[model samples]
Target: MTAFAEERRADRAADAEQRRIDAAAVDARRIEREKAADERASRLNEQRQTDRVRAREAQARTRAERRAARGEALTPGNVYRKGTLALVTASALGSLPAQVLHFVGISPMLLPLPLAIEGAAWVMAAGVAYADERHLPGWVRWFLRLLVLAAAGFAASINYTYGLHLPGLSAPDRQAAGIGLAAVTLLGPVLFEIRQWVTTLSADTNSPEERARRRHERKRRRQHRSIAQLADRFVSAAPFGQLDFEEAFAHAWEIETGTSTPGMTPRLHQRAARSTAALAQAQRSAVGDSTGRGLFGRLFRRQTESSPIQNPNQDESPQSITNRLGSDLQESAPETPPAGTEPPTPESADPAPAVAPEPVAGPVAEVEPVKSAEPPVLRPVAAVESGPRRATGRVPQSARTPRPTRTPDELLTEARSATADWPDEKLTAEAIRKAVRTSSANGRLLRDALKAERAERAVSEAQAA
Candidate 1:
């Protein structure tokens, strides 16, 4: 019993010892797993932080590049420097011919040398200065170029012809003349540029103010054009009679500018057309009135009167007021007959029948009544009777199947069957077309079927004939 008890105690002790070792192994494995998880989390965090740093750096770099580009664009001095460089390059190229000549043993005085290089350089400098002061006109630049060419040509001609030695002139005097000529050529373009700059400055010293004023002026001009064009259309569509000239022009101006400002604001063409129509109406109303003496009356009378003088036979003394006064004067005067026509005799009492007057060619002329020889009669028309009195024929209305209406194929078949026994002249395509045209089917379908039938018949007739 003591040995058994000791063995049992040892077995229990070994089992507990084994359980502790297994628990220690499991705790170590769990520690290792926790460390690996922490390492992975740190690595992910490091990657995310690096990505954020790279993104921020990239954004900063982009912003710096854009800021630099903006700075370059806004600076005007850069443009001026570039223009100066270009002018210097052009000047150098222009001076190359003279430079080459001098490099060789050729004297500039012997040939037509291009001395314009110095003048061009000076002009370019002056132009750049003018551009800095105020915008330069394109024509000014072209004029400067032309001046350079002329100066060079004139200098070359003078050098070649006079050889810098005038009669009765010493070396110093000749040198002074040459210096004066060079000064004239160089200072001419510079002085012109300065004058242009002064003019520009005087005209518009403040740029923003001038720009605003010009923009406002342009807008006003456009408004005026629109108003004038509208007034012209109104004057053309409806004359001054339907539309009052003043009211129409005021309406047009109000439509464009929102104000009924009255003035002679209409265009020339519109004004002229309105005036012509008013003048015509005035002349029509002022006819045959000598007492109404005014501008309108005079215009009307001058157009209507054939005689130059108003009253050629007006006597100084006033005539007696009598109804027969003119008739008595005419009876007292002797009668005179024309050479071609005979005078009327008193013995012939019967007056000739008055000849019917011909109609005048105008809207206001009188129209003669047309006389008819006989009265018009009314007649009744006979009713047309067709073959059958029955309501329906051939196909009945109440049938199981609906009646097949005439189609193009059926129409052509019926037409050919009807004309089958006719002569060749009656059996033509035209006859077939006429026979089929009586049906209310599609004309195109009818024509297509006719074409097929015609082609078949043609082939059969060719074989038969």
Candidate 2:
């Protein structure tokens, strides 16, 4: 019975060992499969990235090709201009050859007189071409001028240097004279032909319509003298015209060139006046004085009184009374209700205290007590001496008198006020505002006047419609 028991135990142990090996083999296979899948994914991702890079490179190449083609098409005109410049440069350089020949005492026949002459003529022709005058065809004009000047210079230089045989007729002198005269005769017809060619080129270059248009423009400009004179007169007036003078002149120039100059002066003046009046009114309102008396007085007073007040307890270094007062007032104020809440009715509103409460001592003092349980209600009480209510709805007599109301006529008056001093081209909004404010008796009055004027304008516009 002991031997049978040992065999059974051995078999069971062997089976358990086999199961453990099988589990490890399965785990290894699963790991290998996962690694293969990851490798495949990496390869696919790399392929996609490569494809995108290739596409971008191809697109860039296409754009480069298009730009290259465009550059090629424009190259001819650029090359022509360059060639013209080169002609001038070459002519200047030719002088060096002539100077070298003279220094070397070369044969009169080899003298670079023609080359030197040609160079100077080319330079002059280049200048003429650059001017782009209307009478000549650009290329032909440049070529003819350069050629003629060069030929003339060549003939003159040769005649001066070696051609003339005056007191002594040396063999070299006779030869140079013959050569120079021959050159002049041969070149004269060439110059004449070039001139004729240039004239013909200019004629052929201009279309009949273009010639007609130019003629018409010239005629129109001549006829427009009166208008031009009028505009100039207006611009020169003492107060610069409210119109932008430069812009108006430019418009006039365009008109003389057969373009229309839109009539804008009346509209410009009307706009200027309106804006000026509006600005004046705003300034007056900001000053808080309608009567214009002591208008800016408060500003000066506030600035002068801004210094710190003397403290009773200098050793203790008393806290800023102003800051403390502000903080205390803020702390003592009741919290405002949410935005949607209905405001309290006049009858239900809590009245504000006439005076602030004194601060209490101790730790509780740090925690400010609310001065009023309810929001303070502002009551419009009539002053003992009744006066006009300001635009701000405050009684003027209580503190400052309200600014006076602007009349319609005062607002309209700004429209006709001399803008002749203003630069024709630069009618600034600020200038207009200043003019309007000064025109009105008071800012508030100016504002009212402007509003009434605008309303009238609207009514008029509607009636016209």
Q: Top TM-score: which candidate number?
A: 2
For model 1, the local distance difference test gives 0.49
- TM-score, one value per model: 0.25, 0.30
Q: How many residue pairs collide in each prediction?
A: 0, 17
Error of 2 at 194 (Å): 13
lDDT per residue for candidate 2 within 1-465, as digits (tens), equals 899999999999999999999999999999999999999999999999999999999999999999998797559655544554454345344333434444345557755554555545544544454444445566766676657566655544644454444347887777765564545433533444444456455655569887888777567558666666655765776375576655555666555445454444445546756766566546545433333223333432343356334211111112332223322322222344445556566466755445545532212212222334345532333233233322222211222212455433443355325343555344443344456644212233333333333444443454443
Model 1 clash count equals 0
> Model 2 lDDT vs. the true structure?
0.49
Question: Candidate 2: minimum summed lDDT over ten consecutive residues — where?
Answer: 310-319
Off by over 4 Å in 1: 1-22, 25-42, 45-91, 100-120, 128-465
TM-score of candidate 1 versus the correct structure, residues matched by position: 0.25
Question: What's the lDDT for residue 371 in model 1?
Answer: 30
Candidate 2 wrong stretches, greater than 4 Å: 1-30, 33-41, 44-52, 55-76, 83-152, 155-217, 224-465
